[model samples]
Target: MTNHNLYLRLVGDRFEKTASQPFLIIPGRRPLLFSELDRMTGCVAARLLELNVEPGDRVMVQVAKSPESVLVYLACLRIGAIYTPLNPAYTTAEVSYFMTDSKPQLLICQPIERESLFDLSLACKVPHIRTLGSDGDGDLMHGLESLTPEMTVVEREADDLAAILYTSGTTGRSKGAMLTHHNLASNAEVLHSYWHWQDQHDVLLHALPVFHVHGLFVALHCALLGCSTVYFLSRFDTGQVIDRLPDCTVMMGVPTFYTRLLSDARLTPELCSKMRLFISGSAPLLAETHREFEQRSGFQILERYGMTEAGMITSNPYHGDRLAGTVGYALPGVSVRIADNNGNELPRGEIGVLELKGPNVFKGYWQMPEKSAAEFRQGGWFISGDNAIMDQTGRISIVGRAKDLIISGGYNIYPKEIEAVIDTIPGVAESAVVGVPHADFGEAVAAIVVKDGSRQLGEQEIIEPLQGRLARFKQPKRVFFVDELPRNSMGKVQKAELRDTYKESFGSK
Candidate 1:
């Protein structure tokens, strides 16, 4: 396993031990065994080479979570081509931005996404474009049927580039985070060993979008490494999840997905009886939401923390007490610290920036050496622009994003503190708080809230609940009730858009 390529170690090395093991079950589709997946991936790898895709060439895949998507990803990795996956739901503008930035040689997409990719490819100067289904005429999957299955696996060193994941930047421009073979493979090994991943026993319910690191690497890699079965969901549906929970031992999702499942009345305790672990990530999990889930489901959600650059950095202990509202201790082989604004280390329990250094830290942003150098300090520590505090128990609590902080009347205010207070109120579903300009104070705290449509809660009603919980200055001076807060495809709150919309509302000094 150590001598072979990372993809080979994940898919081929585990093949003999679980050759006949069910590796995937696509609902109505037939279950694919480990040996079957390995063969199909080998065929796909041969197809990639036939297309003139050489080692180190970027291959961007745009598809929904299906067996084919997994095949495409693994195949590229096996052939030593760097894989970049984008959400099929991205807008034309977003697609163009990524295409231009990545400069990928090949773009694999579905029919609907192909139209946007094609339009973007022309303007972005991308050379090759391929789509799925027969209507596209020159689809990769269809074209591969003519080629003979090749067993050649391009050898890759641990330090070789494996994938490039693009995350939202502070300036609203997308920047690609470069991940190496060692970064991903090391994290997967840690997760597999520490979480007790077994080749024969685990069945993962993979409902999270594959565009994010959590879904693509952590969830999918875990199953591949352990030779476990993954039931991929095209999109998260609470009803579908409840129906499938009986067959799966592990399920991974974001906080919103868990909240939706809890809202669905059909999800009974009996439906979740077979699950061994329910993991949550990609966003902060509220303490109140965590409590409600445990009270109702009788299974504690094992909350893990990760980002687009690095894979799984930390996870709640698999055996110990899983604390509420905390992203448990750092995973084995990962080191984390709290740093001040000047890059000096901060004491525990002090709110400061989170810095991480480990085998999982990415190689850096693509084509942005200046910005990449700024992200790291002296000892290979990547400074995450997120404010956090490490408790005495070594648990981490993310307070708010560094850019999201609001300072009103010379008092520093964190939006997560206010959001948590408001989220506990009865009718409030979710909320986003940002700082708006004001003449008196340097800035005024403002909130945009989403409420349950069945009940209408006024600004006063929302403000009243947070009166005691938050300081007077921290309370939002203006509250706008919207049906839903604007979110990116990954369900992240687009605070920049909110700040732009209310710019005129805050009078000039």
Candidate 2:
């Protein structure tokens, strides 16, 4: 039997060959070397063992991003414990639901939140609780100086649960997506090779939050596999990104990062001349933003498509044409098809639900067997609720989520189509189209827009441009301008929130 623990693969040979090399470069602090990281994780692993955290035990973490928080994650992997990370911004009530759902044996939270969550932990029957601060001082680190490091890596099967990430509960209660060691390792290996990660040569600019897959797994795994250095920012800052762009070779970000960077005049082609790749994910990247970035930076942003269940299913080729609106082809060993609700495959160039099957797909939703069963078809293909179209060349273009499709007056209105036109207008920063309740039309098409500070625009200014471009029913029945759109922790626009805010836009019949 093979020890399929993901920690072993992540640190393969690097502990001896490049143990002293810098792994994380944090501003205003000493660089964390590979050996130092190893020792720290070992110490943390020893502490976890002391607390009786055994293999298969759930360890829930909800602390701000820090090197120590990352160490906790690595330590969980080292000891074969299931690591569950929640967004630090989640309120106590929100966390209460997750605590009840995950039922973790050990809970790690921020120092300030420990007191408030203590009673909740007690109520949830969590045996142990620890604290870890953003600045790396908390109960979790106390008394570590007196403990010996535990360097032993626990053995695990490929199918063993490694992590459980809760989906952003847009519809109902959030479901935990259970990821296995094989699911995580296979995706990391594929991405490392597909992205052309260069060992000891590539420097990654990591500004994403560690709680989500984009930052926690996709970005860190590739760097770890390649033994590369990372310029780790606490969060995405335009100035810090500009200052580091000349030194970093690769950058992974959400669409908001690019839009914010484009807002700054300091971002230039020369500043980004040394950058080898700029990848975007977690949310849809607008075509206008995509082309505008290339026009200014002299490099096309490689946009990939993925969800919490699957790490990364497809990506724009590293050495080929990166189309502005397409997410390129299915990665090697992954199969993708456009299908209807009945599991019948659709022809190319037609919009339909995206279904995929691959080694990287997660096992199932944790503790939700019936819900998990419904997400997959008889042929083992996971039915992704995203509406998409594939061209003859196999390039995938995501139209929108199926739930976001507005059926108004017996017509199907895809929000992305309206948003694309609205975004092209001058003084428009971004737009989100949603379906609001209507008395007669069943649901009315509505647009919530954020305007660029350069100009003052009216509702008609936004709605008038779509007269000849889109059908009358597709045009927004109501246009509302706001300072900005609501977003989740991962920067995806909260369309459900938008729908809720405008639910009574047309008034009851």
Top-lDDT structure, candidate number? 2
lDDT of 2 by residue, 1-509 (tens): 88999999997446666687889988977888987877888999999998899999999999988888888999999999999998776667668888899889899999999999999999999999999997788999998868898899899999999999987433436689999999999999999999999887899999999987899999999999988889999998889999999999999988778878888898889998889999998776767788999999999999998888999999999999999888989999899999999999999989999999999999999888999999999889998889999999999998867766565543335687678779999999999999876644556799999999888799989988776555476678899999999999999999999988888887742
Regions more than 4 Å wrong, model 2: 404-509
Query: What is the lDDT of every predicted structure here?
Result: 0.80, 0.87
What digit string (tens of lDDT, one per residue) describes model 1 on residues 275-304?
888898776666766787888888889898
The candidate that wins on TM-score is 2
Displacement of residue 482 (Cα, Å) in model 1 is: 15
TM-score of 1: 0.79
